[model samples]
Target: MKLWGGLSVLGLVYAALAFGIDQTFKWWMLHVFDIEARQPVALLPVFDLVLAWNKGVSYGWLSGDASQDLLIAMSLAIAAGLWIWLAKATHPMTAAAIGLIIGGALGNALDRAVYGAVADFFSFHIGSFSWYIFNLADVAIVAGVGLLVYESFTEGRAR
Candidate 1:
């Protein structure tokens, strides 16, 4: 419950590591590997790495003709809200979840600022069905949200 405690520091560390790893992978994919010019690289039987620029939100909705400035503003606002939540987090899991959300939001926001869109590279398919392409940041966000949901369901029972 104390500020600057172990949980708080862990949250900060998680945020920094998430952001750093995501950015580094993006840089490697775009600059070092030039993934845009190559075909999808198969990493697994049903997974591949390919470059995709998403100009809008999840699943590419509300992206066409959208303003980059507006998107960036929204992302920043979300990150700020998550940061506030992180500051007041009572549980370590909650703090970690907030950190993941903040890191992912800022990562995508950075993409919007620099490339006018978010760069998605991972692709997954199962026979005929395919999932949307996404990046590490998206993965972190989803995992964080999942943890939060789990916590929500279990918090009251802990008493």
Candidate 2:
């Protein structure tokens, strides 16, 4: 079998889809919906639609007037590494997961390049307990990580 087992196309497709969906949502939110003006709109008892311009890393870490260019460069670097892994991926699940990550990373990097910060919207909370605001790209990245962890546990095990 080839290094990727001729399955790289699956990953490329997933990456494209994830990136498209993420950008579409962000464009609608920023342009049509203007989510910043309509802040804290409750979608559910435990969830809300809000605008959060993250100038930092995950959970608002490393925020300190860092240049957007720097952050975007970092994202691209990480995505390049993931792309290498995807090129060698043999399993469909692994390929998809890596694609999701790369797509999400590129989406966020684009946001930084255009908006000067990552656009976050979803908010989950319960009473006084609140989670960090995030966007669809964040969702894709998290889902990708979950898939990787699950694949790690399941793959190469005797069936």
Q: Which model scores highest in lDDT?
A: 2
- Per-residue lDDT tens digits for candidate 2, residues 1-159, read 233436678888888988999999999998999987888799899999998899888878866556677888899999888887887888899999988988999999999888888999998999999999998888899999999999988875845
Candidate 2 local Cα displacement, residue 145, angstroms: 0.8
**Poorest stretch of ten by lDDT in candidate 1:** 1-10
State in Å the error of residue 118, model 2.
0.4
lDDT of candidate 1 over 1-159, digit per residue (tens): 333544677678778877888899999999999998885999998999999999998888869546778989988988877776777788999988878877887888899989989999999999999899999999888988998999999997897
* Total clashing pairs for each candidate: 0, 0
lDDT of 1 at 89: 82
**Model 1 clash pairs?**
none
Give all TM-scores, in the order shown: 0.91, 0.93
